[model samples]
Target: MAVVGSGVAGLVTALDLLDRRPELTVALIDKGVSGESGSTPLAQGGLAAAVGPDDSPAMHAADTARAGDGHTDPRAVAVMAAETPARVADLRRRGAVFDTQDDGSLALAREGGQQVGRSVRAADATGAEMFRALRDAAIEKARNGSLVRLQGMVVDLPLATTPEQPVIGAWLLCDEIAGGMATPSQDAGLVLLRAQAVMLATGGCGGLYAGTTNRDEATGDALALAGRAGAALQDLEFVQFHPTGLKSADGRFQRFLLTEALRGAGAHLLDADGNRFMLDRHPDAELAPRHVVAKAILDQPGGAWLDARMIPDHQLAEEFPTVLTGARTFGFDLATEPVPVEPCEHYMIGGVATDLHGRTSVPGLYAAGEAASSGVHGANRMAGNSLAQSCVFAHRAALDMAARLDGAHADTDPEPPTFGRDTPVTADGSERTDLRTAMSAGGGAIRDADGLQKLGQVIDDLRAAAYRAWGGPKPPMVRDALEVDSMLVSARAIVDSALHRTESRGAHFRTDYPDHDPVWAGRRQRVQLTG
Candidate 1:
């Protein structure tokens, strides 16, 4: 079995699968060191579970559906909400440590779009703590030879010629990226390997936007790879712009996240005039759903501010030490004044379509985490569900895949055709910046037919440039070029999906049609590549 990513989703899937069937062999592939890749380690918000005394899975499901603005799939949301507690407990048993109350009860925090304080935390760096636990377990497995960790970037998945388009394995490029530059060493080349099952747990496409809160590695590689392999994608347009991203001077095009737990702790969102603007925008004020708060922030004339000075100094230091450090890094003191913040692309709500068991349309090509859309978060995601969804769905996917692989299916599956690394492209590499700039300008925060159409034109132009570059010669398989190629596919899909739906819903807001349409309430848009 091959797990092509090492984030929380991939980690949980690999570990859980290994535990379920200890005789099975697994290979974990990633360009970054295991456990540190993707958005998981960078996540600050805690996981949401129904473990609180008064909370239950039914209540969690209701909140999840409400936050999605009536677009979430009931079955999928129920599964996620129900399984979250078990996953959190599993993490804790595996060594994850969370903050506890004075009596040693689990300390829970309230976040946006929740009726109760059900979010579990590790001092606002929850994901890091979870990853630390999982990472340590994974290292032990590797040392004991139960798992193989391969350092390589997966560039493509080998798909069969049949109409069903089953994937056999993955194609990897041995490359390196450092300080915004990609260079090939002597060993840098391509390799094709077969696997019983291929899991795409790669994170979201936030890197497609210019001013995103995601790191540079989130280039939508897995999303594009799955599509080209004939897997269907859903809801690519519903990119969640987090309501509060710390303003940065680093200018790396990536913004650090200011955890929503701040607002949950009574922080305020003030406009440039030093007025609490969110009160007029949503009934919940600063605690409104992410899309609501984000849209309201964009409406501010001079921009938005996160006023956390009202939070006690001790609380700021103890409960949100990450935010405290982030604020000071940008020369702002959360205990003294309001800090500048903006809405930036945070999460990809939709991804490669998956069933409740995490199977994509293409057989043997399963997906989970930010890379897969299990329909749990239909149009919008609830706060704190990202990590929960990742852990829950990945576990389900691994269990199902493990059972199938244990049967004769792994050997009886039709073989895919011989494949190689995708033909590379050559250019000065301005296409990447151009694509992100256009995506952020036309696809960020707000949308309409006109802006989406213009963005489509830009994607088309870049596609032409890449096609022309591919025709001329086989260029080096540089990481930047590969990422840009993937970005083009994901960006075009986003524009197409954004244009297909005419009405506003959750994170996808159209200026021309500012209200939700009853007709398209649960109608999910899907796309796949065809020859």
Candidate 2:
């Protein structure tokens, strides 16, 4: 009855639930406007689907598993790959117009870790186009009164009054930030929204890092909320870094991502001396898996850059207009100049543990998108798979939730919700900054035992300080306060999982144990926080 966040998963889940059971009361809750928020709009790499004549779901699955490093879930990968084409078609039906070839076929582009071109794109603004269609559809559904939109966040999962269910609703914290009115008191923003079920489509935690491509809103609230509610968070160590983030000289512009499709369009990776170097690192070179290419760039002594000047100006204007305009804003021209590039935190592969259908360990609880660790991408995610994974799993979760409610006494008109009171822990700004710095230095693209140990200690100290502030009279629960809490808990879980996994595998690499261990294959580290 309640879905959190408003990305592809959140929107589609709400839509599909209405499709299956027309009588259900669905509340689509989000911290921003239902359609314009979350990381889905930031997805520029496009969605991976088997649309090429030579491409197939089997090949897509193979590439997904290979990018996953060593421990991706086989069943989840198969489901995502098989269902992706249908999801793409659904997007098209919803009004997404992708670029097409001369024969009017979908324009499939190749990215890293792919054997062939299979990712369908809309120039370089694929995510924007997808979000536009999804947003319009969601808004139309809202107009028809199929679902009501709540501009707020769910702080905790509360239990039902009945003994039969463990968690039957959510605790919301609304504020003026989303144009919602909170209580007169600063520390009084809790409202109990009891429902038939609760879904978390809140996206990943990339905003926790100092150098990340995620928006400021992406603070891993789902991971923090789930861990506190006794749900297991799995594979917390495998955070993926994108290989090409714009880093211009003189620091004039802030960092932004250069989509993998740019490289697929015949761009080159150049060393400091303007010589191609990716070929020496891997057979696929610029098209190699993200982890290999990211690591190679970090290993460069002077630094690396992306040379897109070789790409035709007309093609660049048509296919990479967004990228070109963005680059020009930072004093670089993609069609005529080379731009400095480096790896930055792009995606989080680990998240709240969930089954293939988005059901978490807790009953009546589910998750999708980057928030759910479905194990489809074991160690790392290939470019564009996040969009496909989100769409596929959200549809499945919606179908399952609808089946559970069909003639099964689901509360269509739940009792009017009430308010609850509590002292929210104050966020320590200085400690928050230290946490990000420590995470970036110790648990970032490369890791070692010493660094992870230090990072763990930093998290422990910050967490203790954060809780100590909750003992006295409570202050207002500001946005930064919520984000800092999320950052601390998430940072602790990630570092703890990274420390537990000794061997280097996938996106998680340890300098101490640089080789893959046969004993660790098909294995993963899961964390369930008690505090």
Candidate 3:
């Protein structure tokens, strides 16, 4: 069995599988230096749970449902919220750490869309603490031979090429850039991996946008691979835009996201004229739901700014050392300066449609975390809920996969398939840059039919170029070609999903159709790539 990605979802799922079924063989594949490049470690807010005395799973579910704008799956939200405490406990047992108050109790903080303080954090680096725990465990297991960690990119989903088909494994691009042993010349080749079951926890496609908090490698490889393999995607239009991404005056720090936790701790949003504007827009002001804050910021002529001076200098330095250091490195002091801020594409609320257990439309295939649309996030994810959902769903998926393995016949292991050669397609680096620009302009925070149509044309042209390269006589640069291919596939999906939903809801705001259509109320949009 193999799991693609090494983020919180992939690591937890892989570890769970190995722990439960010791005899099972598992291969873990990651595109970047495992555990360092994904969105998990970049997360600053803590995980949300109902462990506080004033909080309950029901309250958490209500907050999630409210933020989701009626599109979140009730059952899925209930499951995730209920499992939060247990999942946090599980991580604690596995060496994860969280911030504590002076009384020795777990410290809780609040973010947008929450009624009370229910987020357990590690000062401000909660994601990093949790990821460290999981990564350390996986590393230990890998050393013991219970797991095989492969540093490479999965270029394609080899099996499940058609609807309802079973997935066996993936085609991987092995190269030094991806941490594999293969050199960067024509000698670099493709490796076909065949496993009994394959799971994609490959995060989201935030990198498709020109400005995103997501890592550069988060190019939506899993979504595109699933689309090519005939898997269904849901709610692709609902892309979450975080309200505060740091932009320096000199442009040295362009895409660093000033964590939302700062606002939760009382930081304010200031306009170009140095006026606190959010107070007039929403009652919660800086604590409004992310979509609301992002839209408000985008509406400003000079773009919105952040006044971190609202938080004390000592608090800024101790609580958010990473953010403070980044600001200082760029000559901006978080405790005094009015840092320029803008919304950046942050998370994807939609992905390969899957059940709560992570089973997709195809058999022998599963997805979790941002890669899978489990409907816990619905249209817009509440802050801090992402890590919670990833951990809980990853646990469920692992158990389901293990159960499947136990029920399989004694000859469950299939004969290894022959390695297949890949026809490399040449891709221009400039074209990749163009694709990001097009996606940001069309499918970003604000959209309309005209821009979306233009974006569609761009994707069509790019797809044609990729196909031409795929069929050409020369051996193509497979990795570059695949990245573009995946971006094109993902871009088209977002556009199509946006076009299909004629109403504005949550993160998806249509300029032409500004009002939420009653027709779309309580309904979720879905799309599949067919060509």
Per-prediction TM-score = 0.93, 0.92, 0.92
Tell me the lDDT of candidate 2: 0.82
Top candidate (lDDT): 1
lDDT of 1 by residue, 1-531 (tens): 889888899989999999998877777777675555688888887888999999999999999998999899999999999999999989988999999999998999999988889899999889889888987888877776677776677877876666666677787876543321111232566776667789999899987988887877798987788998888999888999998987765545437788998999899998888999988887888888999998898888887889988888888889999889877887888889888888889999999999988899889888999999988987888888999999999999989987888523233333432332355545576888889899999988899899999999999998787767766322236677677778888898889999999999999999999999999989999988652
Overall lDDT per candidate, in order of appearance: 0.84, 0.82, 0.82
Cα shift from native, residue 299, model 1 (Å): 1.1
RMSD of 3: 3.5
Displacement of the residue 396 alpha carbon in candidate 3, Å: 0.4
TM-score of 3: 0.92
Return the clash pairs for model 1, or none. none
- Candidate 1 wrongly placed segments (more than 4 Å): 160-165, 176-187, 248-254, 407-427, 472-476
lDDT of 2 by residue, 454-518 (tens): 88988888777766664422223555666777788788889888988889898998999998999
Candidate 2: clashing pairs of residues: none
lDDT of 3 at 122: 93
The candidate that wins on TM-score is 1
Per candidate, the number of residue pairs that clash is: 0, 0, 2
